[model samples]
Target: MKKKLLPLALAAAVLAGTMAGCGSSSAASSAAHNTAAPAASSSSSAASSTPSAENVTLNFAIWDSNQEKGLRKIADNFEAANPGIKIKINVTGWSDYWTMLEAGATGGSLPDVFWMHSNEIYRYGSNGMLLDLTDRISKSDKFKLSDYPDQLSKIYNISGKQYAVPKDYDTIGLWYNKTLFDKAGLKYPDETWTWDTLYNAAKKLTKNGVYGILTPLHNQEGFYNFIYQNNGKVISDDKKKSGYDDPATIQAMEYYTKFIREKLSPQIFGDKERAEAMENGLCAMGFFGSWNLSGFAENQYMAKNFDVTVLPQGKTRATIFNGLGNAISANTKHPEEAWRFVEYLSTKEAQEEQAKLGVAISAYNGAADLWVSSNKTFHVKSFIDMVKYAVIRPYSNKTTAWEDRAYETLKPCFTGKQTVKQACQNTAKQMNEALAAE
Candidate 1:
C-alpha cells in the first residue's frame, strides 16, 4: 500500500526528542484488544497447518522501486527457507501508495504486509487497521524491539500495543559534491561545523549558476532541524495545540528562512524537478537522510564528488530521524503467515540484506556495516555512524494537514515576505485549527 508524502500534514512543533514519549505501550495495559483486528477463526486453519504446510501466498507492498532488487533477494531467501509461503511485492511511488491505501482502508482490500510511516501509524493503529505485533515481537529473540532506539520503537506504539515493527531509521545529514567544493576552494562540511559555517561556505560556493545550499521552509527538511537546535517546542504538553510561537521556534524558523531570503541557495521545494536538480549538480549542498546515499553515489554527475558529514549544529547537535515501518493488514485472509513474514522481515538477517543492497539505513542495530561496504565511493560509513545521535521525526495525527499550510503561510519568513514572529503566529494559529479539527 502506498501513501502520499504528506510533507506538511504531520506537524512537529518541537524537536524530534519530544515525540519519543509517544509510544508508551506497556505489557501491563489491561483492556481487551480492539475487535478491528482479524478474528482468530480466520487464522485457526492456517495455524493448525503442519510446519511444512505453512505454504501461503501473501502480498507485500512497498513505495520505492530503488530497493526492489535487494528486497526481492531477501524475499527469495525467505521463500527458500520457509518452503511454504511466498511474498509478492507491489511497489508504487509515494503518491500512488497513499492513494491506494486510502481506497483500500475503505474497501478492506489492503495488502497482507505493507510499509508504514510514523505519521500514519497512529491513524491506522488506533482504527485497528493493522495487526498488533506486541506479542510476537516480545517473544522473539530474533526480533528484539529494545535493540532499536527507544524513541524509534515508541513511535509505533499506540495505547500500549505495538502495531508495527520498524523496517529502518534515518538521520539527516549534509550531502556535498566534493569535486564542486574542491573546485571552489571550499572545505567540506564536518561534525564541528555550525549553521553559520554552512552559510558562509554556501555563500563562497555560490558562484556561476551553481547554488550553495538547498533547504525549504517546510517542517521536516527545513524548520524541524532548526527548532531543535534553538531548543523550542512544536507542540503543547497535551499535544492539542501549537508550539510554533515559542522564541526558540521563532529563531529556528528565521534561521532557515535566512538561507532562502539571502539567495545563498535555491528557493525550491522537494519536487521531482528539484530532486533532478540535485542529481544533476545544480546545487552543491543538500540536507537529506542516509536513505538517499546509494542513489546519490550512483548518479553519474553527483557520484563523482559525493560525500556526507553530520548536519551543521547550533546549541547542540540535532538531526531528524525518519523511518519506515512494516505493518500487517487487519483484514488479510492469512494472519498467521502474514505474521511470520513480518517477523522474518524484522530479523537481523533481513535488515543486513537491506543494508547490503545500499538503498537505506536499516533499523536493526548491527546491519549498517553491510550498507557501508556495499558502496566503495567516498566514506559511506558516515551514514551509519550518524544514527547513534539521531532523533526520530516528530509527528502527530494532524501532521500532514497542518504541515502544508504552515509551509505555505510561513514561506514569506524565509523569503523576507513576512517577519519571523508574524509568520510564526499566523502558522501557529493555522496549525492549531487543524489540530483542533482532529
Candidate 2:
C-alpha cells in the first residue's frame, strides 16, 4: 500500500467549498421518487442478502448533479427491493468531491460508497482505503469482470485486487453550432474533416467576436486526444516515464495552442465557460465529452442550434475515453449492504436506467445505444461510433500529482508566456521526476 501526500492547503480550500450547492434532503427525496424506472429487468437476483443484518443506511457520494436524478431513481429502486437498506446520496462538484473524499479518508469517515476515478484510484486503492471486492465479485453469480470493458475493469484492479466496478464511460467529440456553420457558409464537420479543416474553418468562423473552437488546456477532453490522434503518447506504455518530450506529443500540443494564440478561441476559458459560450453562440465549436449530451440536450439554445460529430482527424482519428467506477469504503460498517448496493448499481438493469435517462454512456456493453437514441436532437450516435478510435486515458499511481504540475507548467504556453516547446519540455522534466518518485 502506498500513500501520496496531497497538499494540505489545497485540501483545506476544497473542504471550504465542498458543501456548496449540496441539495437539500427534501429535494433528494423528491427526485428519488420521481425517477422513472428503466424498461429492462434486473439481470440477476438481488446481488446481496441481508436477512441477518440490521437495517442500515449507506452514504453514496458522487460529483455530477446532472446525473443525480437517474442515480436517485436507481437508489430509490434499490431501497424498494432491499427494504432493510437505505441510500443517502451526497452530490458535490468535482473539485470539492475529491477534497471531501481526501478529508474523509484522513478522518476515517469516508462515505459507505463513492465514485472512483482513474487519476485517484491508485492513491486510494494502493493505500487500502478502498474495499477489496475481488472475492465478492468472484463469488457473485450475477457479476463477472468480463461483462465490463476490459480497460475499465482493469483500472480498478490495483495489484490484482479489485476495488470498484465500472459505472459509465465517456469519449470526446466535436460539438458544433449548426447556425454558425450555416451563417459562415461552411459545411458541417464530418468524417472527411482533418486538423487542417478545423484550422481553416476556425479562421473563417472568427469574424464576429465568436471564436471557431475552444482549445481547452484539459488533457482528457482536449489535447490528449490530439496527442493520440497524432500517434503520440502522454505517458510511456511501461508507465515509468512521461512522453511529453516526444516530438509528436509536442507537435500535437503546439497545434492545439495555436488556436488560442491566433485568437481562434478566447485567451482564457475553462470547461464550463466554453460550453456556455457554445450555448450562447459565442463559440462555434468545442471538444466535449459524451456526458455533455444530456446538458446540451436540456439547454434550449444548444438543443436548437448545436449538434455533435466525430472529432476532426489528425495523423489518425482518436479520442480519450475514461470511465468512473462505483467503489465502497474499506472501513464501512455495512460492508454487505455496501457491496449489495454496488453490485446492483453495476447490473444491466441499473446501467440501462442510466442510459435511458441520458445520465451517461452506460458501461454495460450494449446499453450505450440506448443513451445515443435517448436524445434525438443531436447526432449522439457519433460518440458511440467513435469508440473504435478511442484511447484509454493516460494515468499512473501518481497521476494527479504530475497532472496538476503539468497543467501549471503548461499554462504559460496558453497565456503566451512561454513557447510550446519550452513549456512541454519543462512539463516532461517535472512529470518524469514525479513518476520516478512514484
As a whole number from 0 to 100, the lDDT of residue 398 in candidate 1 is: 52
Model 2: pairs clashing at backbone N, Cα or C within 3 Å:
none
RMSD in Å for all candidates: 9.2, 7.0
| Best-performing candidate as measured by TM-score | 2
- Quote the lDDT for 227 in model 2: 95
**Candidate 1 segments whose C-alpha is farther than 4 A from its true place:** 1-55, 236-238, 414-416
Give the whole-model CA lDDT for all candidates, comma-separated: 0.68, 0.78
lDDT tens digits by residue: candidate 2, 21-55: 11001111112223543332343344345542678
lDDT of model 2, residue 32? 22
lDDT of 1 by residue, 26-98 (tens): 1010111111222333322222233445458898877654455567777776665666787787765555666
Model 2's alpha-carbon lDDT is 0.78
Q: Could you tell me the lDDT of residue 307 within candidate 1?
A: 80
Runs of candidate 2 with Cα error greater than 4 angstroms are: 1-52
